[model samples]
Target: MGSSVDAVVAPRGVVDLRGEAGAEFVAAYPADAVVVVSGLPGAGKSTLLRRWSGAARVRTVDPRTVHEACEAVMPAALPYAVYRPWARLEHFRLLRSSVRRGGPLLVHDCGSRAWMRRWLAREAARRGRELHLVLLDVGAATALDGQRARGRHAKARVFARHRRGLERLLAAFTRHVRSGGPLPTPEASSVLLLDAVSRSRARSVEFGAENATR
Candidate 1:
């Protein structure tokens, strides 16, 4: 069973990655930071990383691409349950490898998994690196629409769980920010909140000299 976690609080800083300014901000984001891009299954985490993967010193691990490849060859009627365990195993194996060989890493996250976030935080801390979050705040309807557009969808029960977990996380962050309380996770140095529009506008994820000092 998953370990129980306390409510997540706001981070040290929150930035909206929208417009030219947002793009520029991403370009100047710290090179050494470990950024986790999190959202519901179709909230464009993969899309954003695909655009920015070519940047120097930035490496990304997206499990969806691998899963998609496997799906192409597998029978359409085969239940995902059969291969999901293997896919998860491969994803974490790659994630661990990336963390071990890290310079700058971007991870795709399904917002429902608190254990994954905790593991990432511990890994970053162990390596003396900072972990950050880039959370997508898209509505459930928008996310479901995206799933259809991508021709991939999570089971209804799974999607419902994701929606609830993400909503709670967002709400907790909001409350902490409003109250000016301690951050939710000290392991995470900062969090960036982006909507669909803002995510689209961010063209490149760059790391500059200025960020290295932070």
Candidate 2:
């Protein structure tokens, strides 16, 4: 059985990825904890997690490739995006099962809304696994800048929708944090809110540390 937790009351403000956000995030973590990075679509969540835990130690719950491979098996009525969260469900189940059988420290790269985070915490608690959340805070301009800087895709094609999506993501993040629940640690000694644009070395150290832990 799982335990229910009370909601969190957060301070209000424009929490840009400046110095303050990093301090706030780090203060919420405990020592020797596996960090879960949360942020907007283009908010560098994956980059931060990879840098903090090293790509090798970072186990993602993203089954997008798998879903794509077995696309024919999926319902034709549902779109590709609709299958995203469903695929994540499989990955989460896989992670839970693997941990039971003694697997590596997996860092999930998905949109963990506050409610979802609470659910995950409950599940982890039931299985005696620790959970930590690291929220990536970036401004609209910063997100737009990051999108414009991307070379992997045609930015011109999705820039408009991407920005709108980011806006919704940020609002969701705010709600999640405000309605926060208990963490594995009472309070974290070190929490990293990385500015993906600058400070690559520090980010690499965070990743190195996580990989070393695993």
Best by TM-score: 1
- Candidate 1 residue 20 C-alpha distance from true site, Å: 11
Which residue runs does candidate 1 get wrong by more than 4 Å?
1-12, 16-27, 68-78, 211-214
What's the lDDT for all of these models? 0.72, 0.45
For model 1, residues 1-214, the per-residue Cα lDDT tens digits are 0133111122346544423222222334555677898899889888888776764447888887667766887799998778888778878888887887858888888856778888988887787777888888888888999999999898999999998999888887777767867665555778877787766655566553452211
Q: Which ten residues in a row are the worst by lDDT in model 2? A: 1-10
Best by lDDT: 1
lDDT of each residue in 1-214, candidate 2, tens digit only? 0122111111112223334221112122222234455554566654555554553453454333456654777878878677767766666676566545433343544433445556555655665555655445566566556556764332454545545653565555455456754322232222333355332323332222221210
- Candidate 1 positional error at 143, Å: 0.8
